[model samples]
Target: MKDRIALIGLGQMGLPIATRLATAFDVVAFDISAERRELASRHAGIEATDDLIKLDSEAVIVVSLPNPAISRSVLQQLAPHLHEGATVIETSTVLPDDVREWQRMLEPSGVRVIDAAVLSGVAQMEQGKATLLVGGEDAVLADVQPVLEAIGGAGVERFGALGAGMAAKVVNNGVAHAVMVVLVEAFAMARAEGVALTDIAKMLDREDGGLQRPLNHRIMQRMAAGDFDGGMPLEAARKDSTLALAMAQRSGTPLFATQAAQTVYDIASGTGLGRKDYSAIAQLWEGWTDRGLAYGA
Candidate 1:
């Protein structure tokens, strides 16, 4: 029989991961929201619930959540219910030390914990192109290859041991956040200096292999349409970047750029842009430049 799977959490990222697994595997999914569960059932073919016991029988259980606190809470609840030898995949981006600590907690129960952090955006998961870095026993990883293959259609790299996967994910995302913040700041500055925002972005696009064009264009469209309502909320980015700093600190290193980016993001989140996309950081720049970057109605 195919191993039973339990996917905990149905937030923006978790919902999609559960949905993708459910299409082929018999999945028992859980979320705090009946609305989210209903949405998942309708669109993803998974049986969603709020009960924790439903996970007891699942051999391969996955947890996708935000922050270490929530992950710890769920782990405490599941530790009792999880069967011996059941493989628990921790896909949340968290500190390596936390991952190691969870491993210690699960060890006594005979449950194998793997720090299986997902790479690429949530959108990439839909296309089965998400990369996975699995950090745990190679034998256990081989045992669960089917489930990992199902989720990571593109590739899965099994790092040597626990916490390695999360370390890679943190470094990768830290760089991405840094780049995103720099782009936002530069565009805001160009506009302030009376350089046509569009033209300056176009120049950057041409010189930078058009990497910023899509992002710049998206922001421009939103600005032009006066619909600067979302992209990646500054608050979430702030949290993730903070996560990066914490991870770096633990490693006895410093991320100078990430720190600077965090400051700008802090300003946005402080003023209620916490729910808005990270792109909205540009608004903070507008405030400093005393210019209206707001476009469109």
Candidate 2:
């Protein structure tokens, strides 16, 4: 017989993941919504239930809850009944601290917890193209690798011991969400300036220009090496930012991310980093947090 796996949360992403896992393991699915439970029950390899107690016998449990609070609440309710040596794979997009707390809460009961952040959407899950950013003991992760592969056929990136996966997920999301806002702001300004959106898209799509170069080439290399010297200086970049702001003001365009970025440039320049590379703006973060973010620091 196939190994039994208990799956919690059958929402948008969770439901797809459950169905995918059912292709390999005998999946016991649970959800608070009756409709969702019914939907999961219709799948051939899944056994859907409302009772949390029904999951007690399963050695592997996967959680994909909406938020940390709900995840904690559900885990708290199920903790006492979990069999010894059970491993819980938490795929919720929560903070590293939150998963660490869960690990602490479940450790006394011989329940192992691993944070496996789902890095893709429902469509990716359904297509088996999703990736999992995992953090846990190597042995425990190896034990559950097949289940992870069943859900995330794209790949699994193991970040490190517990909480690292959530950290990676949060950082990845921060960049993606911030870039989205930046794009929106840029598009709004482009529309105001009568520039074709397609033109802007084409410019940004270039392999040697736009987002890729700055992130993958000069700036990132300089920042990573802590060698912020002899490049387009911060002062020059600040001047360019000033020009952009002036143009935006003249065009009656309000900028959010760009305006905020200008503030960082201004502050970094004022602090005598104007002579360094434009990437020196990163130093402000190190100073603010008293942490070395540069590689090998």
Best by TM-score: 2
Q: List the residue pairs that clash in candidate 2.
A: none
Model 2 per-residue lDDT at 38: 93
Look at candidate 2 and tell me the lDDT of residue 271: 96
Taking the tens digit of each residue's C-alpha lDDT, what string does model 1 give over 1-297? Answer: 245688888888888888778767878888888988888888645888999888888888888898889999888988988778888888888988889999898888898888888986899988778889879887888888888877877799876688999998988899688777766655654554566877866777682343654356546665555465666566777888787667656655535655776788787888888886667777777789988777622
Backbone clash count for every predicted candidate, in the order shown: 7, 0
Write model 2 residue lDDT over 76-145, tens digit each, in one string.
9999999888999999899999999998999999999899999998898999899999999999898888
How do all models score by TM-score? 0.65, 0.96
Clashing pairs in 1: 223-295, 224-295, 224-296, 232-277, 232-278, 233-276, 233-277
lDDT, candidate 1, residue 106?
85
lDDT of 1: 0.78
Off by over 4 Å in 2: none
Give the total clashing residue pairs for model 1.
Answer: 7
User: What CA RMSD would candidate 2 show?
Assistant: 1.4
